[model samples]
Target: MDQLSATLLSAPVLFFILGALAAAARSDLAVPETIAKGMSLYLMAAIGLKGGVEVAKAGFGTELLVALAAGLVLSAAIPFLVAPALARFGGLDRTNTGAVAAHYGSVSVVTFVTASEVYGNTGFAIAGFMVAVLAMMETPAILSGLFLARQKGGRLFAPELLREVLFNGSVVLLLGSFAIGALLGERGFEPISPLFRAGFTGVLCLFLLDMGLIAMRRILKTRALTWRLALLALVFPVINGAIGVLVGTAIGLDAASAAALGILGASASYIAVPAAMRLSLPQADAGLYLAMSLGVTFPFNIVLGIPLFRWIAESLGGML
Candidate 1:
């Protein structure tokens, strides 16, 4: 309860709540799209660079390899678990189900970022290599979604879609920044510490405020979100997240890193998966997937799921 209260009262989360409230009240307060985009870019770059520096400090190890492998398995396998539930219970067709399933399987960078902030506030130390785990988790679910939708008859591995999934701007920026940071190491990172390190949380608060606005607005405007699908949206995070935390712990990650894995598992991709689904599974309803991921799941994960996963991680760590 203290942890949850602390999370809700934190600066970034408070700003996010303010944005959501403003949007819900139909206020005209807004962040310009261009500036929001820039903030997003900045957040991703900072996260990537920081992760690289940490990996440089720690060096490669068995935990890193096992964590990456665990992440990949979760990303690829989760869609299969989600698809049948969507088909039977959510009333989605094969393509739409695949699209939605892909979302649950993929990670949300913003959610991860927000959770990292909360983790830091609670004195949980996320390993640097977890960023690589995040980057690696982005795309395999895409392939799985394509496979799930293949029965609908379009080419599964279309050239453009593969390119889009692999070279998505977020993926490119994160990977590029990570490589640069790794090359620079601690000494190189020091020169730019004022920008990437010192300024990170402030930028994240702003970015999350914009996100809260977008998420609330999306929920308000969409007609496609149903109660059943909405329930699934909330449910997936808890289940998948628990599984991720346990897997991470089983693989010998510390509590914080395990919790980080849970955060990634809980997140759904509004940005990358939506674009890929449009290209590959064009028949899938954008409004449905977007509403569920961005509207329902994103907010829930950021607000409640992070702390829940942290507790779960801590408990598991304690038991071991």
Candidate 2:
């Protein structure tokens, strides 16, 4: 309860609520789109770089490899469960159902970022190699989404999509920055710490304000998110997140890394998955997937899921 309350009152979250409420009221308060985009890149870059630096400090190990394997398994397999559930519960067709499944299977960078913040606040040491795990998790879920949708009707393995998934700006920036940070080492990161480390939360607050505004607008305008689908949005995260944490613990990850895996498992891909879906499953309804991911799931995870996953991680981590 204390953790949840703290999360609600956190500056970044408050700013997010402020943006959502302002948008819902039809107020004119808005951040510039360009600035919003810049913030997103900055956040991802900083996160990737920090992770790379940590990996450099720790060096490659058996635990890192196992965690990555566990992450890949979850990312690939989760869509299968979600696809059938959407069909059975949400009454969605294969195209829309698989598309939605894909979103849930993929990782959300923002959610992972928020989880890391909460994890830090709780004084748990974060796993540096999880950023690599984050990048690895994005593409396989996309492939699974395409595969599931293929059973219905849609193009599969389009050359363009293959390129897009690999080279998407977020993936590129994160991987590229991670590589750079890895090369720089501790001494190299020191100069940039003032920018990337010191100011991360302030930047995150601004970025989330824009995100809250966008999520609220989607909730208001989109009719695709039914009550049934909305309920699934909440349920899937808890299940997937728990599974992810258990898998990570079994594979020898400490509490923080396991929780990071849980957060990734729980997050839906609003960015990469959406882009792939548009090209691959052209018949899939954008409003449906977007509304469920951006409107229902994103808000829930950011507000409640992060803290819940951390507590689970702490408890389970201690047990491990």
Candidate 3:
């Protein structure tokens, strides 16, 4: 319970909520766009460097590969299963359902970033390769979702696929940073230690403040999401999180890594997937998926889901 409380009330989560409230209330508060972007780059670089340092200390192994493969499979498979269920239950058409499902299946980078902080706070150690896994898991579900849409006569263009799969900004930045971090390793990290390591949490708080504003704005834009859509948004994470815990345990991850995996699995992609969906599935309502993913699920995961999954992972880790 104490652990759960700590995770839920962490500075990051609180700031996120505060940001949301400010935006929802139409307050004048706003983070500068350039600062927000700069903060994002700093956060990603810091996380990548930290992961690389951990990898340097721990060295690479097969467990990392196993976890990566498991993440890929989940990202690819979850949309297929969930989209139809959502279509049936939430009264969404095939294309919209597919778009929403893909977002849920893919990961939210903010969630991943918060999970890292949660892991550190809980004294759990995660492997560097999981950063790679997060990057890998972004695109496949999008492709799968588009495929599902196409089956229902939705357009799926070659150039669209290329833009989404290959050139998406998040994927490019994440993978590029990961590669740079790996290349630099321990020696390179030393020189940049002061820049990347110092003030990470402070920066995260500012970013979450922005996130709060964005989330609130989204909620205002989408007042009162359908109950069915809301339920799907809420429930899907628990189901996917269970799958992640099982896979992580099977892969012999430590408690922290397992919990992190569950967080990643449970998180929905608001940024990458939405951008792709907007371009690829024009008929799909962005309001439905974006609101559910960002406004509802993202907040839920940050506030409650992270702690719950961490507890579950801890219990299961002990048993294993």
Supply the global lDDT for candidate 1: 0.91
Q: Whole-model Cα lDDT per candidate?
A: 0.91, 0.88, 0.83
Estimate the TM-score of every prediction: 0.98, 0.96, 0.95
Give the lowest summed-lDDT range of ten residues in model 1. 149-158
Query: Considering every candidate listed, which one attains the maximal lDDT?
Result: 1
RMSD of each: 0.9, 1.4, 1.7
Which tens-of-lDDT digit does each residue in 98-119 have in candidate 2? 8999999998999888778766
lDDT of 1 by residue, 155-208 (tens): 679899989999999889888888888889999999999999899999999998
Off by over 4 Å in 2: 151-155
lDDT of 2 at 34: 91
TM-score between model 1 and native? 0.98
lDDT at 270, model 1: 96
| Model 2 alpha-carbon miss at residue 294, Å | 0.7
Q: Report the lDDT tens digits of candidate 3 across residue range 29-93.
A: 99999999999888877787677676766778888788889889989998987887787888888
